[model samples]
Target: MTLKVTDLCIARGGIPVLTGVNFTLAPGAALILRGPNGSGKTTLLRTLAGLQPPLGGRIEAPPESLVYAGHADGIKQVLSVAENLTFWARVFGRRDIDAALAAFELAPLADRAAGTLSAGQKRRLGLARLLVTGRPVWLLDEPTVSLDAHATALFAAAVRAHLAEGGSALIATHIDLGLAEAAALDVAPLRARAPAPDDFDGVFA
Candidate 1:
């Protein structure tokens, strides 16, 4: 699967955040989005994931082939770690949880309630869902937020394996994920300039 973006523009709170972004990602490749806070890295990822509409431009990728993991872990606190994975697998019409469990090293904590797990453990459970989804394109936002170095290594390994199997990822993060071959895009240049005070006053007045 391939994802192509052309002249994309994104907005937050009805104000433009980024404009004129373009990229094409092919299978077995990854793209890392880099930018300071409020630079629209998350906005771009959200737009690409179909979580929000783009102000302008085009994104060409099959809806079914994309899976997005945002800043939130998206785990049900009441459910056990294994149960959460099972639920997602069923939602995606799959029946395997072994790979997801082993991928994030959650096998030992499989039976533990998500609410009882530490922040890092919950994050792992959340990431484990990606493998179970069986999607070809991954849109991840700060996926390693609470993970330690060892867990980060595990995350990198999972991503590497996915790319090796012809899957692609677009990650928005601040730290290195060890995906050296991945293309990088710095969103700083794409940030939209705020309207001048006079322009805003004229419009409001």
Candidate 2:
């Protein structure tokens, strides 16, 4: 599957944060979204994930064909790592959670509550949940935020494998993710343009 964004403009609280953004992600490819704070990296990712609606552009993709892993881990504080995966698996109508947990080296911590896990560990768990979905497109916002070298390597490997399998990804991160063919898109220029007085209301509303 492919992700196509046409003249996408994203807004927050009725103010334009990203404007006139355009890009396409073909299958087996990746895009690295970069920009300073308030430059709309996260906003762009959110828009692509369908978590945030576009103000005046269009995002064309199947509803259930994409997975979004945002800055928040999206974990349940009261649930164990395995429990969290179990819940999500059921939500997505899946049965097997072991393989995904194993892939992320989270099997040993399966029984531990997410609240007890370290930051990096929690991030890994969040990522593992995304893997379980087996979705064709991934919108990851700072996916490697708290991961260490080893975990980062694992995440990169997982991404490589995902692309090898003909999946597409749009990653918003400041760090290089070791994606060999991933194209980088800088959003600063778009954000630099002055916002119209009604830009926010027009775009985000």
Candidate 3:
């Protein structure tokens, strides 16, 4: 599937943050969104995921085919690793959990309670949920947070495998994920500019 955004505008708390943004992501490709803090990368991803409406323009993609993973891991503290994946698999109407568990090397920790895992372990489990989601387009925000070098490489490999299987991803992160041929989008240029002092004078009228 192709995900296309044209002249997109995004806002946070009703305040415009980004405007005139545009991009197209084809199957087997990825787009990395780079920007400084508070630059609206997360807001853009959230809009694409349909968590919030775009302020303007259009996004052409099937809503049901997209899965979003935010900075939060979204794992149940009381659930076992395998059980957590099983629950998501059921939600997505997929019956298999082995692939996802093995993909993130979580098979060994399958029976471990989510609460007992370290920060990195929990992040891995959070990422593993993507596989079980059965959705093609992944919208991830800072997916590498708290991950060490080795774990980051593992996550990169999993993403590469997904793209090889014709899946696409839109990632918002500050560091390199080692995804070959992935396009980089610097959101700085797309950020909304505050109105000039003279322009704002009209608001007070």
Scored by TM-score, the top model is: 1
lDDT of 3 by residue, 1-205 (tens): 8999999988887667899999999999999999999999999999999999987899999998899999999999999999999999999999799998887889999999999999999999999999998899999999999899988988899899999999999999989887878999999999887656677552232
**lDDT (CA) per prediction:** 0.93, 0.87, 0.92
Q: For candidate 2, which ten residues in a row score worst on lDDT?
A: 196-205
Stronger candidate by lDDT (2 vs 3): 3
Error of 2 at 101 (Å): 1.2
All predictions: root-mean-square deviation over Cα?
2.0, 2.1, 2.4
Question: What TM-score number comes out for model 1?
Answer: 0.96
Order of candidates by lDDT, top first?
1, 3, 2
Query: Candidate 3: worst 10 consecutive residues by lDDT?
Result: 196-205
Q: 70 in model 3: Cα distance from truth in Å?
A: 0.4
Candidate 2: TM-score? Answer: 0.92
lDDT by residue for model 1 (35-153), tens: 99989998898989898898889999999999999989999999999999999999999989999999999999999999999999999999999999999999999999999999999
- lDDT for model 1, on a 0 to 1 scale? 0.93
C-alpha RMSD in Å of predicted model 3 compared with the true structure: 2.4
- Model 1 lDDT at residue 186: 95
